[model samples]
Target: MTIAIVGGTGPEGSGLALRWARAGEIIIIGSRDAQRAADTAVKLAEKIGGKSSRVSGAENKAACAGAEVVVLTVPFEAQAETLKHIKPALRPGQILVDTTVPLAASVGGKPTRTLGVWQGSAAQQAAELVPEGVAVVAAFHNLAADLLQLDGPVDCDVIVCSDDKEAGKRVRDLARKIPGVRALDGGKLENARIVEQITAVLIGLNIRHKGHSGLRITGLPAEAYEK
Candidate 1:
């Protein structure tokens, strides 16, 4: 699949771009600055080595225009602005995976506290701002960027939230493309508030433990993925 990571020049975005690119998917790293996007793409290509040709770069809107799936990995402060910037290029049935977590920790507050979002959660806010046709799916909230950047597999479960089941499944499938990453259904988009907030707790735990902590749910049926 052609995946576009808007604001993808940053650590989180670049990390996912590298993972998907190495997995043989086409990756487009998008940035507000076209030149920065190109530079990041070159850096990713250098890291991927043999799959260097699978990744490229473009302006945010242009990247959104060409991809089957677009992931927004920008900080919470920039999420809405970035969505508005790329809204025009989004088409019907395109899937947008939002990985935004509104952590107060970034602003000198407690890591376990979450800032209030007017639209409930960041994903809901994104759905409101994007055009009507775009299907928004919330995911990757608890992933550790450093772990994602590593060459080894990520040992964690990805909780995917979406009102649209098919869209949710699509993202779940994409999540599994990353080695050792498991995807679980997180119910409706409203549930994204919980998924997003969990990041704050994880951040707190990571800081205390001095580790890149990830989640793994227990007591689920073996066929959980089928549902």
Candidate 2:
């Protein structure tokens, strides 16, 4: 499947594009600056170090045009504006995976603290802003971008939540494409409020422990992720 990472010049977005591209998925790195996005794609392709040509880049709206899935990895402050800019290109039946978190760092505060979003969470705000019929799935909140950039597997569990069951499942499947990562069914979209806040906690932990921390839910049977 072709996936577009909006704001793909950023660390989290570029890291995801790199991993997915390594997994043999078609990845489009989207940015406000088309040249910057293309540059990042070239860097990622070089990192893979092969004839791997599955990754490309474009302006945000253009990137979303033909993608089966659009992953938004912009900061919380830029989320609304970014979505509004790309709304025109989002077609019906497309899945939008929102990885934004309402971290207070966006507003000159500590990354360990979170801002209270009136829309309940960043993902909920995205669901409201996107054009209707585009399935919004909230995910990738707790994973550390530093770890994702490394060559080794990232030991992380992705909690995926959405109002649409199939869309959530599709995103969970996509999340698992990253090595050493597991995807969990995190229930309804409203639950994103809790999941997004976990990022702040994880950030705090990272600061206190001096390590890149991630989440893992134990005791879940393997069938929990089975179709």
TM-scores of the models, in the order given: 0.96, 0.98
Candidate 1 worst ten-residue window by lDDT:
103-112
* Candidate 1: pairs in clash: none
Local distance difference test, per candidate? Answer: 0.91, 0.93
- Structural RMSD, model 1: 1.2
> What would the per-residue lDDT of candidate 1 be over residues 42-66, giving only the tens digit for each residue?
9999998999999899999999998
Instruction: Score residue 114 of candidate 2 by CA lDDT.
Output: 93
Model 1 alpha-carbon drift over 4 Å, by segment:
105-108
TM-score of 2: 0.98
The residue-by-residue lDDT of candidate 2 on 1-227, one tens digit each, is 99999999999999999899988899999999999999999999899977359989899999999999999999999999999999999999999999998999999999988999988989999999988899999999998899799988998999999999999999999988999899989999999999999999999998899998999889989977553
Candidate 1 clashes: the total is 0
